[model samples]
Target: MAQVLEFKLPDLGEGLTEAEIVRWLVQVGDVVTVDQPVVEVETAKAMVEVPCPYGGVVTARYGEEGSELPVGAPLLTVAVGEPSAEPEGSGNVLVGYGTQAPAARRRRVRSAPAGTAAGTGPADRTAAPRNGHAVQPAAAPATAHARVTAPAAARPQATAPAPAEGPVPVISPLVRKLARDNGLDLRQLAGSGPDGLILRADVEGALLTGTAPARTAEETVVRTPVAPAAGDGTRIPLKGVRGAVADKLSRSRREIPDATCWVDADATELMRARAAMNAAGGPKISVLAMLARICTAALARFPELNSYVDTEAREVVRLDHVHLGFAAQTERGLVVPVVRDAHARDTESLTAEFARLTESARGGTLTPGELTGGTFTLNNYGVFGVDGSTPIINHPEAAMLGVGRIVPRPWVHEGELAVRQVVQLSLTFDHRVCDGGTAGGFLRYVADCVEQPAVLLRTM
Candidate 1:
């Protein structure tokens, strides 16, 4: 018997719990090999290609293009295990915990017999092909839990410690498939197995006692979320990159007691220094890199702003290393790609790293590893032709420095009024980390470095 296996959305780590399907690469009925890219998804401002592990015929796909899917929602199902062959899988498509080959056991599959009506509702989930013959959602099963998958052999292994908590703590693919086919959300059922593990008996019991509600088989097997049609004048979905950005900013606003400080400085010296550095002919340095270097120097002096507040432990976590994040606006969306260690890098290194990250951001190829664990953020809204902005802190970071356009405006240079390269700098910091004095001190030091690039030498 050909066994059909479901592939759910894997966790696109670093706190990203959902992704929007951007495109579909395979169709139902298409025979696929192990580790083939099956779909394109955008999560946390990055586009990632999801690969299927099993080499088999695609049986069904879930979700439509532009639809959102949670971490553990079903992505697709594949029919493997041909009459005589044992199908192979790599299980390395996801980052961690490579899933192994499916159990080779001959546990009976309970599909309906010929001429008998297939029991309707979730129990009979079918695969719909793409290409208009039938529709397969680019955005499949958006949103759900991220659970660890344990093989059948491992499933029966007795537990020694207390039951681990979080997400769906269930075993038995047979039971899970049963629930999915019957339109039962595994999360809703109470597991009577060890440590709240959901067992086959519990699910069957729920169905028999009318405890779990199931949809009819005629209902769509996969979730096909409807997006607004062109010119339909509907509210734009706050999903994918947009949704992730909104959530981070909203959380920063809600939890952070923030304050903003701004000052206009004669960036004439900073620009001149950059020009000189380029004239000397190495890989040219960017003004943003200069500013980032200054920020790192300033952060070293005033480390208070480089730390975030721990609400649970009620402690202020001060980080020794600097993982600097810079805001890059690309066609995909605004993504903040982080430099591993900003404090240690020179301007040349910063410039190169910034260029690399910007290119990746534009291509939507940045990984979660490149986008998270930031100590502070640098927002260069200057390219947008703006003067300044009170930037929202990229939580759970303590601060963000906003840079405005560098224009030749009339400024007091030395003691005379002159048309010089001047730029506005704004710092938005969490109030819990430090007072206005410390924040003001950090900003003033940054301004000093911008006015006279040599001022950075003091801290360097």
Candidate 2:
């Protein structure tokens, strides 16, 4: 007899409450090793490969790809212990949780009798070799509430119960919600997905074919709409990263009394300094990294801006260490990846970390910790060729410094009109954190450093 264990999505940390399933790495009946990635999920912060802690034959998967499941919800069930010959797991944890040794190669468990539920009965069915090929078992009648494992050969001919008679083979909650909203009985329709799994498409297809009648206006449930009117245009659901950004920005606006200050600065010296550094070369420093270094220096000078207003405590808390956040735009959306203790890192280290974080942001591999805990933010909108933007302060943080495109512009240099590389800097600060004097002093210090890069030596 094998003991069946259920694995739920672990808390991925940083206050995240839920995640959307991106892909399934294992199938029912596949043997999985401990700490092996069983599924990939996308939280608002990043894409994460969730590993199963228990090693066993996968008995059932609970959700479909693209489905959102709350934390602590069942992800899958694994059948462990028994007359099974698979190696026992080392009981190691995922990255950041603890150290884990290399997992042993996965071996398939011998299939049990056709009608036996997983984790039950003796090994009476035909046993297959330890080769990678899957063992196909005889097809059994599908159950309404549980997913049954069968051999690949039986999938094509498997008969699913009628929707009107048994539980519908549906995995996604969104599909169930869609059916409910349209007053459709899921049990009546035959699913087209594997093992007769009812998908969103199946429900949608039934609607198009007029198989399910639309609810009347009076019967329709009224709720806050996520998207706009149907005739307006295509409505993208405000979910995932985009939704998180929207909610944060909205809350920042609602709660914070913020003020913006802007200035034009000569960045010719900063550019020249960067060129000289690169020419002297070990590792090429990025302009964003230089700007970040300057921001850290400025924060050190005006520590008030490096603080957040604790509304519940009715006090402004100033932080000592700078966890510098830099905004990077990716296909997913705008994400701010933070560099820890940035005030303590040199320009070279900052450049390397920025490059690493930016790459991770682009690849959607940043962890929740990497994306949060910033005391200050550096927004280099200059990369986008924009002149200026009054950026919204990342909530709970005191201020964000926005840098715009640096281009040759007319400016007075040494009392003579000359073409100099000029850039626009804007500081958005929470009014409650500090007065305009503090914000202005910080921006002015940043501008001075940009105009004269050597001035950074005093802080260094």
Candidate 3:
């Protein structure tokens, strides 16, 4: 006897309501252990691998890659306990959502003959479980078909064809696959399950009646969407990381009355200081770390910019401690990973933290917590070879510092025209939090430190 356990998507935490399926690690008929990573998903905050709670043979997967599923939606099913081969020990189990124990079980039937790929086959008439109900698999055909689909666990009720227009009334993924493989439009069938839900019997009935797509039709027409030809223009859905970024920036633009102030400063001293420190035979300090240190010092003098405006409370909340967020653009999208207690850390620590976070961001392994809770943000757009940008405030945060590329430029040094490494710095702050005077002082101090690295030593 085998009990088919239905596994639904779990709450990924941090108020995430849904996730887009990125890839499936296992397929139908694959044996898995408890807590094995079954699927990889991309949520608004980060990429996560979801683990299965039950160890058994994978029977079916609900959603396809690139499909979005809400939390608690059916992800897959596994035949636990009764499946022949079992692993020696359970691997690392993730404490995800809870699942119901098997209520009952029955042996699978193998009487029916296996069918073809383009036609109906032996359906795993397992009464699919839902909403914490124990699965009660029905007696299934023993024959292994070229393509077999899982049947929804439903009570004994007269099944009928569902409407063709609007959403399809199918519950069993196995039935969906069967109709899909045979090219039977489910819209043409009336469902018999509760609430007109299409069941496996409905699909099998259609196949037996020759309503399935003919051999020539199956060969010519497929259910999958074809790629757009060149010049056809492609439409990528705004979802996942890209969608999250779009929403956050749009909200920042809509709610924050932001203003930008920028200035070009001689960064020759800062560059020389970095070279000196690295030449001292220690971990090389990056320019971003140097600027981060400068920002922290500047924030101490003008803490007003290191705060966010609470609209509901109608107050400007100034944070005493700084959780610094630095922007890093990766293959997925732009992500700001926060370094906790950044204000308390030195230049060397900031450099190490920035490197770690940047690596995590590039690999798409940042957690939701690491991606949020920042008092201020540092945008080093200079890495992209851009000199300047009036950066949008990362919503809920009061200000952001933008750094441009440092390039050699002729400038007046001590009343003498000379070539100096120069860089542009911009500050975008919420007008509600601070006025131009405070913002100006902060930027001026930062520029002063860049012109003379010794000024940062006093802040130390």
Candidate 4:
């Protein structure tokens, strides 16, 4: 009997309510093994490959690529050993949890902590058991603390003193391969590791110490940028992150009824505040920092705006804490890295976190959690000096705020025309969820906060 098992999309990580289907690695009717990457999902930040939990043939794909699916929604149907009509729990397992099976016959067993079960997959390899029989695995490497070792009965004594911290571990596999192939002395060089791990710096250091070959003049030549041929418009393929962005933007424009409202305000005070903060600096702060802080405070006053619409439930899921996501333009595409509990953070912490988030996003090192669960989004078009532009609403969220360029403009001050730094604000909302009144109020609140920088401190 060929059983049909419906595999629902599992929760990728913390606060990830939904994911955008980036690509399908396997087509329908394709045989997939347990832990094989069956699909790729893009959650605001990075694209992650989702593996199959069970070995079976893919019966049907429930959702198409480029579709935004909620967590626990049916992703695909797999034919295991039973028919599709089988009940949910007769033998089937839920998403994230493995398949249901009878309890293992216990001999004399020991216990393991949570998330300690070793995964039997190519992504993670566990050392074979010394007992010569396949048994429960020990020391799963999911966590950083996990170490591969022989059975507890047989252990070796530690001999070497662990290497001290500093730049030495940051060397990439490619760099290591290059060094080995070229017979470079890695130990002779100083490292430029994250915390000072031995990286290319150490390799260069070896050359300085006469332990490695010095680069030839030909190898040190800098290449100049070439002008493209006339009428040859370069068409970059929108694949991976860029492709995903296009799909989402198209979907948002096509599906959501976006209502955009614009406001012009004096940004002289906000600009001054940013200048003062930059002068006093720890991390180099920008106008984006002030906008983020203002948005955090404003969301509190207009909680209805800081929410996502659940279409299935036809209810507005208002988030209690503000997780403000910023639209950062990266080489890959636009990535929205969520600042978890933005309301709880101070100016300094928020600035630092923003820097970390942008760094991680650009470096392609953001964790699953950092990209998920954004209540609201802020896009700074001001950097490019746009007066106002209608921004696409990030799906699920009711609205997205766009900040336009702040330039000196003539305005009335005490019955006299005066020049002041002014910027236009654009707020686009999903009309189905948020009414005109709610949207207007939210924009007004945000504009007020930005216009009066002191309101942020008072609100906090």
Candidate 5:
């Protein structure tokens, strides 16, 4: 006899409460090894492949694809210790496993009478049958006859009659929100999903057809405003990376009293210095890395900008090491990947670290640790071709430095009018951590370094 074991979804870290099932890697009856990925789930952070801890034959899967399941919900059940020989699990931590183990012996439940499986109670439907036996309802002859005679349009219409009682069949909270946002009532629509499970498509279809009821004045007033539409206006849920960014930025605006100070720096020398370094070449250093190196030097001179305020303790905690975070925009969203101990690394090392972290950010493989713990941020919005922006401070951090494009502009060099490569640098600092004078001194030092790269050598 095979012992069936239930595997629940493990905690994927970073306080994730739930994950949406994106795809199923394994199916029922498929033999799987320990730590083999069974399903790919999308948390608010990233897409993660969840692995099974026990090696066995997959018996049943719980949630449907696109359905969100809370942590600790049963993901799938496996039959272990079968007659067929299979290797045991290696007991490695993939995500993180639950402490509870499956029962040593399987409990037998009373089977529903034949032909009544469709009408069976929820408890009977949810319980797994002994020995991996499938509990299927017998086909109803009358239902088949009615379906064959009904027209295609009539069939869908008839199948989806309004529910008389009980809760709605919708499973995803997102689907519910979508319906509520569009003023579609869940009780009226027929679900196209398995066992009348209302899906997002069902609600969307009702909206497109104008079948969804119009919202009352009160409902319309309460509904959140939708994003600007180009064509038919597709709504993207702000749940994953986009949602996190929204929440953090909103909080930063609410809590931090930040001020911005900017200076136009002559970056011709910095650009020339970069060209000389790359020409002397081993690994070609990027302009962003050079700016990051300058940032660390300036922070060393003005440590107040490189600190955070601890509200709970009522103290300004100045950090000893510089954990530099740089903003990188990818298809997922804008993510700040932190470079640990950046103050200690040389320009070459900084370039390499930036390249590695940027690659990880683009690939969406950055861990929560890499995405956090920054004393200061260096945002190079120059890549976007913008001149300048008063950027928001990444919350809890004291300040952020924004860099604009370096372009040749006419300037007076040594009392002679000439063209020089110029860049605009802006520093947004938390007012609580420092006053205008301290912030001005920090920006002036950065500008001096940009104008004459030799100033960084003194710190070096």
Candidate 6:
């Protein structure tokens, strides 16, 4: 007996919705195993290699390469036992979830040339104008039916006269800037340079004509105030992570009625722990790592905060596992890479994971997986020496905690006033799932853990 299965595009994390097929690794008539990478999909940020979740003989391919397909749409059909046409409604397989459809095969076309004008057909030189005549183009030099002609040898003729010397080369902008600063007349300076090109040495020679050392542009000290240009000031187009962050933050603000709870903490012990840990040095972990660790621990203590408010269902599903997303600043913009199941890991593991995520993020190596599945988030503004800031929650995550810088501040210690390293924690939660008391307590738990680093072990 022969059976067939179809593979469809899976929900590629986040609300990706759709993806463009970059390339197909397997083709019809090829045998493939379950979980083997069969196709490469290009999303907005990366080209993710998606694996086949069902083992079968590929029978038909439904979509061609370079086509955009929605999640849950059939990609290809495979014969699990026998080949057959796709069944109604059931052929739409979810990657890791269903059967592939019989895809149509077509050679993928290259992307359209950027800025190509619509309605303008491919250029035809045959109809072009030349010398007041509509000239039909001469046949291209090499073709199968074209005649091959060889030129006759040149007669023993007189040698042609030598070519005249061309015009002198002009000075470059940098060279001119250098010359002006050096007070050298560019014209009077006969270039000792080849092809009359002015070299920096030539400019220096002109300046050195008098006393005191002559200076070339490189050696000159000249400063000029830059004038404002005619257009409106710098216009920055919002796109990529920065644009995504703005959109998300706006949505979170509008949809989720958010409330914040703040807590002050003595970061002396936390700072000491960080220094000691860095001394042992595997991955030089920082205060942010410790803060992320504390945030995860606090979320574990309060599962209510680890849930998203389902407005449609009118319910909050508290997650059983921890997927903690941390805010990272990169040259591209802000990104949050999640540490999946963070509650299962110890401080060392968590620190290593956080370091890995941040390094990958900064290097722009983060896969869509690392950017999604976050049930909670932590954003550290402490690096900028701020006391606290209310970071917007990464949408779909219930809450986000902001960690501020650790600085020495006066506080009553025992009976007398003393300087203590203090940092602030700002917790912003979805008001629908968390009340002020719950939110406050959850923040207080994190603050307590940071205040006493040893308490984290017990909490974990």
Backbone steric clashes in candidate 1, count: 22
Where does candidate 4 have its weakest 10-residue lDDT segment?
222-231
Task: Put down candidate 4 lDDT per residue, 181-290, tens digits, no spaces.
Answer: 44554544444332334434344344344556443454334211231221235434344457567877898888778899988887888888888877885776767767
Q: Each model's C-alpha lDDT?
A: 0.74, 0.76, 0.76, 0.64, 0.76, 0.64
Question: Cα deviation in Å at residue 331, candidate 3?
Answer: 1.3
Off by over 4 Å in 4: 1-237, 278-284
C-alpha-based local distance difference test score of model 2: 0.76
Model 3 misplacement above 4 A: 82-136, 139-232
Candidate with maximal TM-score: 5
lDDT per residue as tens, model 6, 54-123: 6767665544575555565556645454323322223344433233333322224344345433221111
Per-residue error (Å), model 5, residue 35: 1.4
Candidate 2, residues 1-460: lDDT per residue as tens digits? 5555556667777677767888999998899987788998888888888888778888767677877666655677677775443334455655432213322233244565465567432221222312432233334233332343332222332354454555677757878987776577787777655556665656666666676744456555352143222233443555678878988999999999999999999999999999999999699999998999999899888999999888998999999999999889999798999999999999999999999998999998898889889989999998898999999999989999999999999999999999999999999999998899988999999999999999999988
* lDDT score, candidate 3: 0.76
Instruction: Return the clash pairs for model 2, or none.
Output: 163-187, 163-188, 164-187
What are the runs in model 1 whose C-alpha is more than 4 Å off? 1-3, 81-88, 96-233
Q: Lowest-lDDT window of 10 residues in candidate 2?
A: 121-130
Candidate 4 backbone overlaps, count? 16
Per-model TM-score on C-alpha atoms: 0.71, 0.74, 0.73, 0.52, 0.76, 0.54
User: How does candidate 4 fare on TM-score?
Assistant: 0.52
Better of 1 and 2 by TM-score: 2
**Worst 10 contiguous positions by lDDT, candidate 3:** 116-125
Q: Tens digits of per-residue lDDT for model 1 on 1-460?
A: 4555667677677767667789999987899888888999888757988887777888767767766565665677776664334445674645531243443333354564454343321212233333522222232231121122322112242334223455666556766876765566667676654345666655665565666654544543342133211233433445667778988999999999999999999988888888888999879888889999999999999999899899999999999999999998877677899999899999999999999998888888888778888999999999999998999999999999999999999987779989999899999999999999999999999999999999888767
> Which is the better candidate, 3 or 6, if ranked by TM-score?
3
